[model samples]
Target: MKNCSNFTNDVVYSIIISFISVSCIYGQIPVENDTIEDIEDFDIIDMESTLVEEKKDSISWVSDVFSAMRLGIQYGFTYKAEKPDKIMNNRFSFRLEYSKSFLEYLSVHIDTKMFTFLKNDHRIRDEEDIVALEGRTREAYLQTSFNKTSIKAGIQIVVWGESDYAIVTNEIGRLDYREPLSLNMDDLRIGQPMLTIDQYSSFGYWSAFFVPYSEFNEQPRKGTGYYYDPFDGKVEYLKEKQKGNFSEYGLRWRKTFGKSDISIMAASLIDNQYALRMVNPDLITKSKQRFFMTGVTFNRAINNLLVKGEVAIKSEKAYNDASFQIVKKNALDASLGVDYSPNSTFTLSIEAVNYHIMDWSDQIQGIPRNNYIALLALSKQLMKNNLSLSWASMYNGPYTNFFNVLSASYNWNDHITLNFDALIPIVDDARSGFYPYRDQKQVAFRVLYQL
Candidate 1:
């Protein structure tokens, strides 16, 4: 299986290179001028002037396309260590992406990634193998005029809302949840294979997506985890069941008025489910469960002060024996924040979040308490956009604990970049039963390239 996956990956890379080579050889030679002959034929008194402006716009558009396709590469090293236990690790990663337009109304984009890592160093007897294959498709179907309306399908990213540091329904960030310790990707939002319609006018933009449920199953689960209850001495072991199907429908509307922008999104996850089976055969029969989430965001820039916020509510219906369980869990998560930028090079931001479990009723005696988190961050750009530094502190109120993070990034060019991130635990009075590693201090670095 590994060999086959690698072989397929190599083939895709070769195709990407071939396509870029052909495009470079036959691509149109951009023209520099500001007159459209057809427009000059019009009878209007100012026809010649209007035609020149239109021609300039056409020339600039072609210039932008070629610049966007320039090759770039990034490479970096990341190291993380937790004291006492000697949890030392290192990782290396690389990425390549290309973008070009076949015509004025059609464009294409492709991205490929590679990651490798060494876990626990020599402290552990065996080395861990870590790698991932990721690819993206964008602008496969597009057509537009001055109004900027277009249609797109295939794997493409859809970005909406105005929250700065946090995203509510970012599927690409979902991968980070699977590896909580890894450095976050900047474009953490990725495109699933779906059909999208976008329309833009003087007011703003409106977009909608029609994604089929079947395409989401491209990734498979390797195993399952067991959940245990110490207070009641109960254990629930879940096994992977047959993959389920679900479709996501989304709509977003945004408008910019003066210095402020307002946007809203409505999305639904239909027929979502996870495979589940209890350790005890007599407990209950297996069945599919459904879950859904809804979110909204707003942002405004008032002079030196910029503010943004988002709120989301998620709910899932209980199935099998879960319905009979004494304590069910549903959640509502929200965040509000503001940033003050005294200058173009420096900014300060403060944000607060609440993760409230709606099922936390007094009648449910053993349930975990809701959580509140607050964060403050300051950032500075230096060396003419080559270097950036940021510091952040977060307090998780429910546990009466705090965490601090210091991070920096250096962009050598459009292709190569480097990043450094560190996490420090200032307070660790978290709920006793949870793993202490969640509150441990660690640091890591990463480098990336595009070619």
Candidate 2:
């Protein structure tokens, strides 16, 4: 165990050293005259309309390389109704990225991120805390051409599909259930080296990514056997064992026709022995465990009306003695909303979505066999873009009646902002208890600074 920990640390340290060395070497490269002039005359709004011209201008290795030096800090306080407790947490995150023009036809990019927890609070468990840092990244690699095509290697993130507030991909953050709140902090999956190809055309854009198998350092392990007690139905614990490797690959395509856009994506994972045993015991003896998913999204705008929707299907092979059984699950989600702009200072928009998860066989028990959700949101801007107020309500069918959220934000400047979030429960049911939160109400206040 100690050896494994040491080896993990060694790998992390080596990655950090390499990142620093490359960043320093590239940081010393002098900016050229034409590059400086081009950046100065660059217009962000105009570039959006000219796809080909924008792509050519945006492909600057020097500007992207230097833009990698960034720092950020966040702090927040929370109050929960059930516990009647107050907790605070803070975080500081930094990244250094470097890009260089190896030749007119090729460019290299590297990025590294380091994070630190600044404050601790017990009401929020470490596992549920959004400010916690699991580890530091050593390097992220990207090799791109002047054209739209590029291949990236090293630790990085790839996002596909389109869901308003949530995504179905593996790159999802852990939810904080202690306070019955979900706060995503962009700290989900670690950076994995991947190869990607991207193309840009007048119609739209397309990208594809492939990631080799790798194990998550923070993934939990289960003990050998389960124990049953008279009072407690069943108890499980962690056991020390050899970890395994896993790899994921995906393909995505998108096209735009006038005001309407469409996208389709598919992804699959291949897990090795140890991981297979932990996630699917039925597949342990089969050499590899597989998980597959496919999704589609469509967004269209007619006049002042905008509509968007997504649907997905996921399947996984059982792990137990019935390893041959492949359980299939389906999810259907769709949202329709419209934005109304009455003058420039006042704007109002409303949207609603329905999420449904199909039930598997009776054998798969604990999970909800079927579920549905609906949401409504409203927003207003005050004093231009400096201040804003918003409210959202979510109803989770049958179980919990509804959840409500109210938020307000004040932008002190371009680099600093303050915000508040509150969660309220509108209905309560015994069988449909709150799945994400325990209490009826919770509130949080946060401050963020970017550099």
Candidate 3:
């Protein structure tokens, strides 16, 4: 193994410094107390009472500060169903979320995540071989509002659609697809640096955002369980093309009327997911394409039922043909979702989504001409709402590929939580789509502590 002694030492020191700094900043504030006195000392007792009152005031301020800051520590373990002795992942993570207000109309927010590996795995390469430490600044932004207008700048995550199961119009931000079945919606989002402005008028609400440089999706690393390699790890992969250093800009208009809300959006951006193009027989590389997209979304609440829908059209979307050449074509995406909730404890959601390549041809190898997907989800709260259980499934009609998740979460106390999940992916049509992830069935357990 190549020597990484210096790098390892630096990582350890950085972790120690970070932990100490956080502890000193938010763990507790020390207050000095006077010496205790005997019962005969009445004057000292009075002074002690005064000091106690002052301490109480100081403690109140500390509590207020604590309320604005939150820290979450989590440890997660995943076991492969096919091989009990092999571990898929054993990791620990720390997350911090904070919000503070200065002037009356100005505020700042931050969210960060740090992770360290406790087990050696093939997912990470040699440089990050053992005890790999990774960090991400999910969001860090400053926001200010004046009258009916608000502006924000910094790294941020923005969702721009109404569909929960389908990303019909929510393509503005990059996403993490490393653990698609295990991670939640919020966890999959990746923040991007951007400037945004919003204005409220009598007619509607208008919003705009500009990203100086956009980022692509974070795909699973090579040698991971979910990573896809068409050549079965036999080829030398080349560097991807046009992956970054591009701008993204978008506009949106939204309004709420009675029980209904509607939004219209448009953007010019690069696709976060890349398409593979064959450079040679032994070399395959990825490429990102730019496109213009426009969409509309709406939702209506009627008593115990909610209806949502979205429609989007992309101009000159890129894909790979059967000959392994990049091709651009127009595409249309649409989704309709319905949610039924008779009470606060139980809910059911169903959605149908479609992606159609306009002027379809048989030469497209990456996607079908008319791809259809369906989603079903059910969730319930139990044990006085301290425990939650959910089941969700997504099925692709054309390729007979599907994924299922069964999860449960229990709040052990105010600051601790336990979670368990079973993730299963089924691929029946080997000729239609990539099935490299079909054998990744696993069960995961996690413990979270929040302050």
Best by lDDT: 3
Which residue runs of candidate 2 sit more than 4 Å off their true CA positions? 1-68, 88-120, 123-139, 168-180, 183-191, 201-204, 214-234, 237-245, 270-289, 317-363, 425-433
Where does candidate 2 have its weakest 10-residue lDDT segment? 221-230
TM-score, candidate 2, is 0.63
Residue-level lDDT of model 1, residues 272-376, one tens digit each, is 233344545334233444456667777888899998887777675332233334223566778889999999999999987776777565553322456677888
- CA RMSD of all predictions: 12.7, 14.8, 10.4
lDDT of 3: 0.83
- Candidate 1 segments whose C-alpha is farther than 4 A from its true place: 1-76, 84-89, 118-148, 167-173, 182-190, 202-204, 214-245, 270-289, 292-294, 315-331, 362-369, 411-416, 426-436, 449-451
Please report the candidate that would top TM-score against the real structure: 3
* Cα displacement (Å) at residue 174, model 2: 8.5
Candidate 3 residue runs with Cα over 4 Å from true position = 1-64, 83-85, 127-129, 239-245, 431-434
lDDT of each: 0.57, 0.55, 0.83
Q: Please give, for residues 1-451, the per-residue lDDT of candidate 2 as tens digits.
A: 6467557755765675556445544544436664533443343223333543443454554356557555556666655555654443344546555656666766666556665554454322344454445345644675766566666666666655444454444321122122234423244334556677787877568777776654443322121011112224242223334357556777777898889888887777543222222234222222445566677777787665566666666565333223333344554445555555655555455555554555545654333555566667677888777899888777776576777888999999989989898877766564454532445366778887877
C-alpha-based local distance difference test score of model 2: 0.55
- Give the TM-scores of the predictions, in the order they appear: 0.66, 0.63, 0.84
For residue 79, give model 1's deviation from the true position in Å. 3.7
